[model samples]
Target: MITGGTTVNGTGVFCACYIRQSRKKANKSEASPEDQRDKTKGYSDNEGHHFVDFYEDIGKSGYDPDAERKGFDRMMNDARAGRINMIVVHYASRFSRQNVNIVLMQVLELFQLGVRIVSVNEGEFTSNNVMDLMNIIMRFEAGHNESRNKSIAVRGTFEKARERGGWLGGLAPFGFEAYKAFVDGVEIQLLRPRKDESKVIKWCWETIKRHKDDTIKQGQRHPGSLAGLVHQMHVDKVPTRGARVGGAWKDALWEVTTLNRILRDPRIAGYMAEPYGNGKKAAYRIQRNADGTPKKYGYDPILEPAEWWELQAWLDSRGRGRGLTRGESLLSALRNPEDEPVLNCACDKSMCAYYGGGTSPSPLYRCNFRNVPGHNGNNTMVQHHLDEYVARRIFARISTAEEDGDTAGFLLEATKRFARTQEAPSNARERAQLVTERHEAAQHLKECEEDYKSVKDKGPATRRAVLEEMDAAETRLKTLDDALKALAAADAPALPIQQWINSEEGNGDPMGEGSWWATATLASKRRFVTLFVDRIVVYKSAMRGNRWVQYDASKRVSITFAGEGETEEASEAA
Candidate 1:
């Protein structure tokens, strides 16, 4: 192939070879980065172009155009800097397998700058001729179709593996180790409890359990406050479970959030969860069987299901007790409207609830910021009235949701759709299959359109056949397009708030099941209030129509509270 000092043909052509192989569950046996680089370099050498550099992204997908692929970014930078005249790859698919229009746009960007692309397998792709460019796009479309097919196939493989209790390979979670075992004479990887790591996991649970008991007996701190346990672990010098296999053990201090995550995970209760998608699109949901019980994958249990549920109870109870200040609020886990952090003043700072002062006695939320120099007025509102108003609104939303029957079914369907996307074809072979189908369908439609455009006065039967074929092909393309869109719009985990609303049996009104807001404990009320209400702007009027006259009993008070992203959160969570 491209040996040392082999190129001398294309005098002014500086070629940068691009190579990519997605890292998501890919094996070294499949088109390794080195092989791609070598093959691309050889093509450049044979073409007699100056092989300037190799731009490579190992284990990165070609589907996401905005993904931070280092090599791809560098290649673009070099092209912008005029460091290279030609971009070479084993195939144009190596450049991208995203939407055809998107890939064409990127190619046009370089084309405008006088840079050429060389797909070793397909030859040069240039905008020099309209026909040549269309041909190049056709080749790219084929690659795109292949990419989708491969993605579908990969997802199917994972789904099959999961169903058959296969490991579905990934990094072992906190107290577990991924081990290979022979099952029916075929080796399969699965998670097993690591003795040392398991001890740490047990310690976390045991410590919380002990605290739970202490709280029940003494009526003090709750077991869910994990920051103390985190501190204790640090004091005990417990090593963090970073990377288990071929990864160094870290001295990282554990956090309450980590404890929160661990306690919440169904895996701790001897279950398996398969993670799919990435970033904001990611959802690490429990893989369940048809019976709604968590699916098993040879995962060793860290805690009994009952104990795990108990742990979750403790974790969810954090920041919900007596003597909690406005600043110390719980904004997670609870579904009751009373648990949201809703108390705020017109000044934007948190309003402190205070008892009555001198003359007119009433419980009030006083704007603490009014004491500051720049602002004026002792802006205060009756806490009971504001709380009632906010609570009513929350219940109304819940009631509306209830009126829209079978929200659970809709949500379940959405979740299922999301799960499918998560399992989208991830490997080259499967991706090739999916994308190839689309490309063929696309090509068939392209041909039909071309034929339609080029048609002359022909026999009625032949013309009718062409028209029917074109309509069929168009329908097939639309179906494929819809499927791709479904894959791209991955589902997020259903938010707890929506789940709670669905679970509750309510009359779809404020005073119905939503009446729990009235009887909720102060701590729980504060927690719920924060979820939607931001601030209650209080205004005091001294007179009815005319004036700034001194008034006490005659003073009129009006309160308006802002809804702090409850709707947005509900939409996202759902």
Candidate 2:
């Protein structure tokens, strides 16, 4: 006996429709939410009454109804509050799984809560007396049919969308744009290379090919013009998404920074990448944290193996920012051992390059192989800082050991581990190991060379085979030379370890004149550190109280005091 329309605030009325679609319905080829929303809009017109706002929990699997989702709870609350007099649903199962029998509970609960209910798909409700087993069973069958039909439609939509590579929909990189293109469902369109930047990409590839010299530039000297080439794009009025982001040239264009995107674009190599960088090409830049330290390899690769090497060569030759390589690595350390080298790159390929050549210049090392974090971390150092970092670490360690009267023990242990010390095989073993590796290498080279010489130049393929053999022989010879050097041991202390370990500045100070310390070459001093300690990491000071940084690279410098037992990055995770 409802008279004036029941006040929906605390007295539930009009139908509340629940449109439960299959979980597989999400991204399925069936109709979109917008279209479904529109269809629901029509129901209000047909019924001639206002409805509670729709509650959508679209992609949820019905089996777990209380899986901490939003929207669904709000609907239930309104029902409990009697704010909704009637509940409308496209079907009963839309409210929950059939096995849970949620529809009967919702009906009984609303009735107890002082709310009346009406279902759009099911017939109007009556007194509890008439609603017998036969009626309830019929209603359940209707709901089951609706769920099945909806599932079929959704699956058809997804199968079509996936085949077309349509707009699955979400944000992508910075440069390219996205659009729609599927037929049965929503389609996705990806970025294609723009014309202007392609020319520049080609230029970079050509440069790498041009620089591939074995004897002429055997050891890898990065080319000098990589920066100029990137700049040239700007000079030629080449447009980039860089223009849109503003600080591009000054921002992304720098070496190992933005310029890498241009050179590494796979569009220049051949085809579109599986998923490319935002820039017109599928150029994947390495991932980094907000602070600029690399987090992992980039999602997309922008440079080619050859082009990347070329860029490294160019940066190596530059010596600093003016010629700084694109990313961090040990090359920087090699260029400026006085400065610390970057220790690692998180690139999956793991082989990071280093660069040096700046004021208070420091070398850097890190991998650029892949963009997966922790994946390529070894190829890429998780972190690196300051050029003298490793040296500083070793010196500091020795200083501590000297203070603790463990100087002798530290040096002895270090030499035993990494150098040819007394504990090492005596002169006889040293010479034997050296001669053995050398003999093997020499034999390998001779055999390869002989094979090459004996091969007749009967055809083009024969000549090519011989050339490959000769190249292999040369590589083997170089390996042999390096190995023999490693085996050669000199036991005589350049600076008597006992003196260095015993002096007042024992581990703290470098050798003094003939007074209390012996002399050693810079090479030897550096070698001493490497032979014992591994690496050191520098860090920004912490703001927390009484912060101390401890370096654990088995080495440290005593050039300055780190203060009362402070811990640095090295200590946090060495």
Query: Over the stretch 465-568, how does candidate 1's per-residue lDDT look in tens digits?
Result: 77887888788778777765554345434334443343234653333454454345655555444433443333433323223743332122222223222221
For model 2, how does the per-residue alpha-carbon lDDT over 356-400 read when each residue is reduced to its tens digit? 333324343434334364442222122243333554455556656
What are the clash counts of all predictions, listed in order? Answer: 35, 91
Q: Look at candidate 2 and tell me the lDDT of residue 553.
A: 28
TM-score versus the correct structure, for each prediction: 0.47, 0.35
- Badly placed stretches (over 4 Å) of model 2 are 1-12, 19-50, 59-69, 101-104, 114-117, 125-532, 535-574
